[model samples]
Target: MNFLYLLVVLLPIAFGVGWWASRRAVAQRSGVQVSELSSDYFRGLNYLLNEEQDKAIEVFLRLAEYNHDTVETHLALGNLFRRRGEVDRAIRVHQHLVSRSGLSDAMKTIALLELGEDYVRAGLLDRAESLFSDLVAMKAHAPSALRHLIAIYQHERDWHKAIEHARRLEAMTGEDQAPTIAQFYCELADRSRQHGARAEAREYLQRAFACQPACVRAFMLTGQLEAEDGHHAASVDAYEAAIEADSAFLPGILPPLLASYARSHQMDRAEKFLRSLLDRYHGVSPVLALTRLYRQRDGERAAIDFLTAQLRQRPSVRGLMALIDATMDKVEGEAHENFLILRDLTTKLLEGQAMYRCSRCGFGAKAHHWQCPSCKSWSTIRPIHGVASE
Candidate 1:
């Protein structure tokens, strides 16, 4: 009991000494007597630490009043509000800073940048873009503003603007943006191809390749355009180069490559290319392609035998589904009924599964994308190969 009394007595003394130390630390930092404001600051900090948000906001508001001339205080308060999703408050605070007549151009630029970020958070992208564009034009925080402009253009699917600003940013910053510029060109090429401006599409693809020597997207687009326009031989050449550049894209490339070869009646090349693909790629697409090639040349029985052997090695649900479908035609009675149920279950299993994923951000999708819509990274979304999936 005496020990408890001693601890209680020492606790207040310890707190008082610690308070003095804290005042000293703040005085050293702020170059002012924070002791007068320390009580409210500590109370606010305590509320924040304890997740008492309402009281914390009240304390910070008081701190902002006590430190009205302190730019750092206003910036910190606005950033805290922004982090808490109070973007309107953040925008208002940053706007006030930007409007302050005597503020340094550098400080005003910082506040404008923060305000632009707040506008983005609020999904007011048009407002954000204008502010950031102004900063870029003024050459104040140009690189950061140009990056934000590029992001805005990408989000808006205005690929041309993105390409222009990305190139400008590269020139200004001396950073390598070739990969991104190639992707932007690819986007333009795709749009041109879809709109039947085939010649223009090819021009953009040439630009993509110029930016990135071995750009897989440019190769793919070249193959696609050639194939669609009945230049099967050229299409095969481009698709082959696409695979050589990046074997990870073989699944997408091979389908078109094989189609082009078949269209040109080049069965020999198809076999040779697919065989080479299996050697380079461990994914099931090549295996399945090989199975079909065997089935076409030999017979159904040969295809079934080939698939069963490969499935033993890879064990895929899609392969199993194919195997089951192949076997169902020859089955009878309860065996056939059991196969039907199994097929249905497998179909359901695959129904909700994402067949592709963004390598950059792990965003899952049912369809493939040459560019990640989430992270805006190029050539990142790819086939998700596995047992119960693509």
Candidate 2:
């Protein structure tokens, strides 16, 4: 029911109808039927434009009955029904197209594809899967079919099948699905880790690294596994590698990484690494981590000085909050009350802000996701770099 999409579909049909009307008019020298058909077509379009979908559908259905041989009209009607969330109507229209006696094999496959999509919209995934599998076997629209099958497998959490089909798609299309394939491996690794199958998890992580050498999620998982095994130094290495792999994920990576650095008694190394990040990565997270480190080692005054200097450069609300908290202890009476109010306001501001967003679809999230929940694209959701966020 997208207005533009409706126009695009109906305009072609109108042109065809007008052409047919001209032919009949020349042969019979009668304009009555042609005038009625044109009026009906325009009336249906008007009804659709006015959001009178029921009336529009009725008129289009009559048109379909009159032009039974026009396969494109049926296809467009089915697509329109699907887009309007009338999945049952869409399925019936596509089924009728597939069952028609004189339909070409090419047209039949297109109808089958449309029917499969309608099934998906109706949450009949098993039926959709069967239809798409048949299309793949026939090698008619195999790429599209494989993509849908991969989506279905991902929805069902069937990572093995998803990975297999992804590989097949890559080989078929030469699109280099390595990054997506790596994410699937990471998913498998996470599942194995949750089930306490450490070796299996490690194997999956290895495969993930093989697929994409600089995969940040794989490196992060490796760090987590090493940390769980009490190998703090190795965990530190993996975590640092993760940051180096993708600095955009620094906000998510910093906390656990800092903990590992502390447990391994690498505060000096931590300071050096954080300082290095400041040179290239302009984020409040690294600045805040450095502030805490300085407060623990060099004293409050030194921490405040460093944070104050960094804030002048970054201008982060989080940085401002840190500065307020650091100075609150030095204030008294009305000054202390004012500082408390400021802190609460900053906390509220931060609370409502989206910390992560999908680069592909612009879907905002408070937490990081490796795959976009909206577009289902892998490695597209990353930390939002702004004064209120990263």
Candidate 3:
């Protein structure tokens, strides 16, 4: 179905190119050349439809060589080469176009942009950066060049440059870029925090908040910085704010938030918060956290009762595992062995299951990430909500 659809889409473009080639031949008063060019064009289209890309490329390359003034033909050939992962061939085609003396300024800039993309595909980042930078400076295709520059900076982990170009893109396009800009700030903050530059990290966090007042990552980082300083109360405040900013991050936020509550001797507050979450959030993390709190503060009986009620409300494999763990000690011999088997089965069921997934791309991961590894989109990987997950 897809192959047929591709053929249908390409047929019109093929006819258009053939018509253009025929008209050009007519203008040159070459009757035989017109038939020859149309014949070759259809042959190339036939090869393309049959998935013989190498032969198609050869035919198209011949057509492009025969008509030096066919700018669109060369561009199409370069794009086809790039799509086929023949970056070297794509570069050569675009470079030939760029080096042509009679090429218009607009065509030259487009060719340069295509060459820059070819460099990116070939892992020639320095060359790509230089080409894109020149395009941005020339302001010929500034927005597209800025976007490519931002992508390159991100790949290179140059957060400052990424932020700068993103801002430039926003100014040129009149679009809201604060959310993306905040993520860039968060990246810088994380780097500073890893290097133990606490003050610098804080500064970046502030900038992130300035860009996006309710940035969830910035709040999480603030919680981490406060926790590192042994300011448990402050950490609790920041973490609670993070949850409020984005409840989808509960699995990642709740563990550290619970620790901060314990360190600050705020079990009552933790219980209240977890209870509130049970109403608003449907995930099992809060239930498990509350059960643990009850087990520690109240008794095993209270914890079991609470867990049983919650399990009846929301069925969960993890909740069942916790319930089994609580009651396993009461059983003996054959029953104890059965419980052990059940626990092992539950553990295996949970094992290797992706706990988080990207909202943008549906990329699954066992662990959470601020940016999705597949899509490279920030804050899109959220905890998976289900019976087996949070």
Q: Arrange candidates by TM-score, highest first: which order?
A: 3, 2, 1
Q: Which residue runs of candidate 3 sit more than 4 Å off their true CA positions?
A: 1-15, 27-29, 46-52
After superposition, which runs of candidate 1 have C-alpha atoms over 4 Å from their true positions?
1-33, 42-55
Residues 313-349 of candidate 3: C-alpha lDDT, one tens digit per residue: 9999999999999999988999999999999999999
The TM-score between candidate 1 and the true structure equals: 0.86
Any residue pairs clashing in model 1, and if so which? none
How displaced is residue 56 in candidate 1, in Å?
A: 3.6
lDDT of 1 by residue, 263-329 (tens): 9998888888887766667788877887888879998999999899888888898888888888998
Stronger candidate by lDDT (1 vs 2): 2
Per-residue alpha-carbon lDDT of candidate 2 for residues 211-298, written as tens digits (9 for 90 to 100): 9999999999999999999999999999999999999999989999999999999999999999999999987999999999999999
- lDDT at position 343, candidate 2: 98
Best by TM-score: 3
TM-score of candidate 3 to 2 decimals: 0.94
